[model samples]
Each structure stands twice: as structure tokens, then as C-alpha cells.
Target: MRKLLVTLVLILTGTAAYLWFEPEDNPDALQTDQELLPDYVAENITRTLYNEEGYRADSVTAVRLEHFELLGFTQFEQPVYTLFNEAFQPSWKASSKYAIWFPQDKIILEQQVVIESLLQNELVERIETDTLEMLFPDNRLQNNQPVYIQGKGFYIEGIGLQADLTEKTLQLVQHQKTVYRNED
Candidate 1:
């Protein structure tokens, strides 16, 4: 009984001391700080990236892009990305509802991520996922969500994928199913 009483007294005394020494925050100052937070915003942004050969490597158009000055990088809406081949032709295209891009050419596309191959004289395909991570310049695209691929006379379902857009190679990972037509 005595030990319990002593413990309670100590806790009460410590809490009282903290309350007495705590610094007070000015509500007006807090509001002003929030108001003063700087941000950079833009609409209809078109960014084109080039390769070492001075050719157009990639192009991106966004409906709205905004970033906070204090926060470095930020949120983008309706980002459509296109990649080019060595012949300076469109190789593939991608788009997403939203994305967050880092400085190192890393982009995380969220919500209704779509990728399509645009190689000439080849079977066209469309790949869909809930989320995808793309590394530019390196031309690497990966996804960790369920990926659905559809093309003429065929359909493929997979859990993940790793693709090299530079080399035009794709490797699907985990729980994959493919259906192709014979047509022979």
C-alpha cells in the first residue's frame, strides 16, 4: 500500500513540474507559419528528356504538378510518359492518375497505371497495374502489384514485372498466367 502511494505521488509531481515548465505555443504564430509555407505550382507541364546521343529519350506531360519549396519534391496529376527507341521512334508509353518523383529519376506511379508498347510492325500490348516504379535514364520499369497484360488474341496475368525499356526487355515475376491463340 505504501509503495503504491509513493509511486503515485512521484508521477503526479513529475507531471506537475512538466506542466509548469512547458513552453506555450502561440496559435496566431502557428497559423502564420502555415500560411507562410511556400509552394511551387504549375499546370500543363511538358518535360522532355534526352539521351547521350542528343536524341529525345523520354517525354512527359502532366495536367497539374505542385511541389512545396520546403518539401523538395512533390505530387503530380495525370502524368503521361513516353519513351523513345534508338531510331528516335516511340517505343513505349505510360500514364498514371498520380505520381511522386524523386530527384534520382525514380517515379512511383499510383492509381490505374498503364503501359503500352509502341514498337513498329509488332504486336501491340497494353499492361496495367495499380502501382509501378520507373527509373528514368536507366529505362527501368517495375511493379509490385497485380499486372494485367492484354494484346491481340492473348491475355497475360502476373503479380509483378521488371522491364528494361532501353533494351526493350520485360521479365514477369510471381504468379504468372499467359494465354495465346494458335491461329494456325
Candidate 2:
């Protein structure tokens, strides 16, 4: 009789707890508006990136850099990323007002990003865009914004662009128009 009475008390307490408590649908719900601020910050950062050949392929200088652990990304202000050629000279220059480096070696430069090729290549010398996605190691750049390319006494405007810095190629994906001016 005592054991039966204890079991009944246990059952009643368990049911009462179950009725009063409920688990949250998401205990660690991600807050989209809440940003993981940088725990460590730096100023005037000069970071160099190496290629597969273990050579200094590119370098970036930023006025400020911040790393966000929860967001899993890094932010840069006034960044200048310069790519070097075989001669160790600056071949391409990419600068932006603001930039973010995400996981997997991808970079997004926003706010008036300008990419310039100093190789004296007639293909594409300068490209201006509001934002660009730069996949390092592959030396690839892409954007869906309006692009302006000027080089070799030729100017062109395009809606979208995909460029291979290593191959020295530029393809305007949409709304391409050659805006030529007579030097004569």
C-alpha cells in the first residue's frame, strides 16, 4: 500500500510538472538583427595572402579590421587589396569603402569598389562597380551591378560582369554597350 501511494504521488508530480512546463521551440534561436561584434579589433592592418606556389600573391591593407565570432565573418574599412604579378609587381588593385571577408576565402567589397589592372593589358584596365565578390586563390571577381570598363581608349558599360584576373578576361553578362569617344 505504501509503494502504491508513493508511485501515485510520483505520477501526480510528474504530470503537474509536465503541464506547467514547456520546452522552447528554439532555445538558441539565431537573431538576425543581433550582430556578433568584434571581440578583437585592429587598425591599419596589412595582411598578405599566399598562392599555391607559396608565393605572396596578394596583399590587403585596411584602415580597420574586425572579427565577429558569432557571425563568423570579418569586416574591413577602406580596404585595398592588391594582386601581384610574376614580377612581384602590383598587377591588379581592388579598393572599396567597406568590405567583408566571409568563410572559405571569399570577399565581398561594397560601397564603390574599383578594380584596376595595371598589367598594360588591352583587355580590361579598370572596372568600377558598387559591389564585387572576389574569390581569392581562384583570382575570380563577379558582380551583378552596373559595371564600367575603360581601357585602351575604349569605354564600355555593362549590367553584370565576371572577370578572371589570372586569365585577363572580362565578360559582360548583360546589357553590354561600347561607349566610344572619338579622340580625333
**Best-matching candidate per lDDT:** 2
Q: Which stretches of candidate 1 lie above 4 Å from their native place?
A: 1-22, 26-38, 182-184
- lDDT of candidate 2 over 1-184, digit per residue (tens): 9999999999999999997896755635545434655868999999997768888899999999999877889999999999998777789999999999998889999999999887775567789999999997888999999998988777888898888888877788886788756742
Clashing pairs in 1: none
lDDT (C-alpha, whole model) for all candidates: 0.85, 0.87
> Per-residue lDDT for 1-184 in model 1, tens only?
9999999999999999999999899898997786555477789999998878789988989999987555556678999999888889988889999998887789999999998888755453788999999997788989878998877888788898898877767778885787887642
Per-residue lDDT for 126 in model 2?
Answer: 86
Which run of 10 residues does model 1 get worst, by summed lDDT?
A: 66-75
Q: Residue 71: error of model 1 in Å?
A: 3.2
Those runs of model 2 whose alpha carbons end farther than 4 Å from true positions after fitting are 1-35, 52-54
Cα error, residue 27 of model 1, in Å, equals 11
Candidate 2 local lDDT, residue 44: 98
- Taking all chains together, the TM-score of candidate 2 against the true structure is 0.77
Residue 5's C-alpha lDDT in candidate 2?
Answer: 100
Per-model TM-score on C-alpha atoms: 0.75, 0.77
